[model samples]
Target: MEILDPQNTVLTNAEVYNIVVEKKKAFSSAPKDHRASPALRTVIYETLTYLSGSPAATQTEEQIKSLIRALSPYKFTGAEILQLINLRPKTAVEVQLVIEECEERLTEEQVNEIVEIVKQNFPIQSETKNSLEAAEG
Candidate 1:
């Protein structure tokens, strides 16, 4: 396959998870003879399993877009924004860890604001959800 727009976009894990899920559904619905290879099927299954157990599973499009818009003023790098979405940090320390040079770039209040923004955009994953998943797993 040829590469088109090699750097057209940077996708968060949630977006990747959604895409993988769609591909998995398509693969399952295709004729057996026309289905993807065994290796591809294995990859899809493994990826789905991992993503389901991760924070990405709970992420939604609206949340992600809102988060990006809210955080744009901070001028964080794409990688940092992606990390923020994936980790859903709840504390200043966590925000500091994700954003490079936080000590210099982001004030204490800014860091705290980022934390609140993350919390507001992606609420903490509930313990009940985790427990239910653990039980199911």
Candidate 2:
């Protein structure tokens, strides 16, 4: 079967999740005897699980895309945006750890902006842990 990405380009994890789940639904409605092969079913299950990110990162994906685009002029891959949405880093160090492979380092201000955007959507749990550490230290 020839598969086409809806965007006519590479898909992000969330987009992949939507497409896979939509296909799964279509398959579910088909005649049971005509359903996907066992191997394909297993692959679908694993893909769903891998893309099912934290329930707390509840912002609509369009919002996430907008946030990622805000970092432009910096140029991030779609995979990086997906990981950023899933991980929700809360500081410059955390953002660096996520996007370290980018050709250029983000300035402190830029990292802070990205962190703030992420925190607005999904505050990483580790931020509280880091806050406690700062208080205790």
Candidate 3:
């Protein structure tokens, strides 16, 4: 059997501990209620899993929160905002209006980056696929 590189494996306990400590420090210094909204929390959790290249099931709520805190400066709330924009638009004008509204707070580049992250972390599934189609319809 070939020898595997240790660096290619998962983080060691010490590394994990250090990360947690740093995360706590960052989180403590952040503005209160940065992630107080349920919608914001959901977006933060999803973004953390994507950015870490880790399975969502393996992450604890605290870990998720920590990662969110670390990325606080990004200011955008990941997939949740995308989901909102995807909601049914009664007319083309309405869709255009919504896009215009979103453009004020989020740049197209940021939105595109979030889309790419989602594509990498959560491959589209039948249920998700159908829901998105339904939302558009």
RMSD of each: 4.4, 8.4, 16.6
Tens digits of lDDT, candidate 2, 21-97: 88899988999898999999999988887766443223456665676766565677767776786666767787888
- What would the per-residue lDDT of candidate 3 be over residues 5-83, giving only the tens digit for each residue? 6566444222343454455457657798652456645655555555344233233345434444543555545543333
- lDDT preference between candidates 2 and 3, better one: 2
TM value for model 1: 0.84
User: Among these predicted structures, which one has the highest lDDT?
Assistant: 1
| Superposed Cα RMSD, model 3 | 16.6
Query: Candidate 3, which segments miss by more than 4 Å at Cα?
Result: 1-73, 77-100, 126-137
RMSD of 2: 8.4
Models 1 onward score TM values of 0.84, 0.64, 0.26
Model 2 misses residue 89 by how many Å? 2.6
